[model samples]
Target: MSWRTPADALRNELIELFLNHPTESLSGETISEHFHISRTAIWKHLEHLESLGFVFDAAPRRGYRLLSTPDILFEPLLQPHLSTHSLGRSVLYRPVIDSTNRWAMELAEHGAPHGTVASAKEQSAGKGRRGRMWASPEGGLWMTLVLTKPIPLSRAGELTLLAGVAAAQSLRTLTGLDIRIKWPNDLLLNGRKLCGILAEIRAEAETVHTAVLGIGLNLTVAREDVPALLQETMISLSPSTSSPWTKARVAGAILSALEPLYDSLCQDAAGFSGVRSEWIALCAHMQRTITVRLGEQVVTGTCVDIDERGTLTIEVEGKRVQVPSGEIVRTEVW
Candidate 1:
C-alpha cells in the first residue's frame, strides 16, 4: 500500500526537514508553525517517525534532534538524490512486500502513470528468470519501474537489454568496479552475479501496452542472509568496495540512468541497436563457449553476437543459431 494519509504525508515532510539538517534540532514550535499544525500534531508525527526506525532525542527547550535513521530506503531520503526527469517522479516505498514486480504490475493495471516506481526493503516472494526464487533479504535493493507508454511488443527483449546497460553503468559509477553485462539481463562484478533485471510486458496482439522493469541488486546483504546454495555463485557489492553503499543512492543512480534509455526506446524501436551493441561490449561471456537452456533443449556453442532485435547468436556445430529467449546455464572460457 502507498502512503496516502495526511498524517503519513506530514511525517514524511518532518523526516525531510530532519534529513536536511541532520545534526541540528528543530523545535516543536517551529515544526508546528511551519506546517500550520498544533504542537500535539507535531508530536504525533515525531512518534510515527520513531516507529519507522528513526531515533530522535527530545529536550525541554532545545527541541527534537535526529540521532539516527534506519538503513531502509525512505522516499524522503531518496528523492533529493534523484535528478531524473521521469523514472522516479512517483515512488511507492513499502518496507516489505511480496514482490516489487508483481506490485508494479498491479499498479500499472490500475492506471499508474509512466515512470512510477515501487521499491521494497525486503521481498518475501522475489523472482528471477525461469521462475527461480530470488533471495531478497533485508539490506538489498529490490525495485520495479513501470512504463505505461505504448511500444512495439517486438522490442520488449531490447528493453530488458537496455535495463542491463543502465544498471551496469550505475554500478560502475558508484563502486568503480569492472561491471559486466551477462547476456540478456544480469550484471556481474569480477565474475560474480551482482544484479539481475527482469522486464515483463503486457501487450495486445502486436502492440505493447505497459512494461514493468524489475531490478534486484545485491547491496550489503550479510553472508548468512543468503541461501547456502547460492553462496558460491551469488555475491553482494559491499565486499568489493572500500566505502559503504546506500540503497537510496544506488537506486537513484539506476533510475537516473534509465530515464534517457526508456525515452529512446519509446521514440523509436530501432534505437535499441545502440543498446544491443553496448550490451555486447559489456557482456562477460561474449565470444566464449556457453550452454543455453531453451525450454526442453539445451544448446552448447560459442557466444557469437546479439542481434539488433536482442536475439543471442551462437555458433553450434558449424552452424549459426539465433536464440530469442533462454537462460545461459554455464559459461566456459575455452
Candidate 2:
C-alpha cells in the first residue's frame, strides 16, 4: 500500500511545481490546464501545501510562487538529502521536550525499530556519561538515534567512538573549524568541550533489543549558563571565528553525515576501525597523559591507543594495560 493518499501526493506535487518552475508564478488556470484538473482542485492542493508549512505568494500578474520553506525536520527538508536506510527512517520532531533520549527509550520499549530518531529543540533533563546533568538549550542539536543490530554486547562501546567522529566531522563541515574528538565521545575545540555523545543500550539474553545514541552540542547558549565546574567543559565556535548556523541546519547536517558512517558499520568491522583511526588523529589527548577514574581506582597514565573495542590502553606502572571503562580526565583524579 502507498504510504500517501492521492491528495497528499497531489499536494506535494503542487508545491514542487511552484518551487521548481522557471517563471515566478503559474496561475491556477495554468496548473489546471497543464494537469488537466479543475481550477478548484489546483487551489485545494495549494491550501493543503500551506498547511504543511510552505509559503505561497499570490500576485495579480503571477498566480502563485513559492516563497519560503519550513526549516523544521519535515520530509521536504530532509528526505531530499537523506540517503541512509533504517538509521534515520523515522523522526520524532518537537519544538521542546523533556529529553529526546528519554522519549526515545520509551519508544524503543514499545517496538520502535532501528534507525528511529528523536529530535528536540531543547532538553530539560539531558545527561551524559556517569549520569552527569546535561544542559541542552535551544541552540544545539539534541538527538537520540535508536538501533538494534546483532552485535556482541562487548562491542557496544565502539559505537560511542563512532558517534564522536560523526559529530566532530559535522561541526567541521558546518563551521570550517578544526574540531577534535576528546577521549571517548567529547568533541573538543582547542581543549574545551564543544559536543558530547552518550550511548545507552539494552540487551536480552544474547541479543540486543535497543541502542540509543544521544548527541548534544552547544550551538548557541549563554556562556554564563555553563556551570563554573564545566567552564572548561563548554566551548563554542566564537562568533568572530565561526560562521553562524541555525540549529535546524545543524541537526540536518548531523543526520546527513551519520547515514554513511552507519552503513559502513553494517557492511564490515573494518569500517569501524577506519573511522577510529581518524578519530585518534583528531583526538585531543591521544599521546598525552590523562587520568582514568574507574570507580575508586584513579590511575594517571599516558594515553596510548584506543582499540577498535573502544577501550583505553594506558601505560601505568611500567605495564601496558587496557582500561575498559572509566571517566577519562585530563587532570589527576586522585
Pairs that clash in candidate 1:
none
User: Against the unseen true structure, what C-alpha lDDT does each candidate score?
Assistant: 0.84, 0.73
Error of 1 at 256 (Å): 1.1
RMSD of each: 2.2, 5.0
Residue-wise lDDT of candidate 1 within 133-244, one digit each (tens)?
8889997899998898888777777888888888898889888888998887888877778888988889999878888999999898776888898887777898789888
Look at candidate 2 and tell me the lDDT of residue 126: 89
lDDT of model 1, residue 91: 71
Total backbone clashes of model 1?
0
1-334 per-residue lDDT for model 2 (tens digits): 3322466446546655665784577887889987789988887777765765678888886688888875555433555556566656566666678877888887787777777777776788887878888887766678888776655565677778878887788778778888888777788786677888988888878555578889887766667776678775687665625566755566667777776766556554554577878888887777778888888988888888988777889898788878888877654311
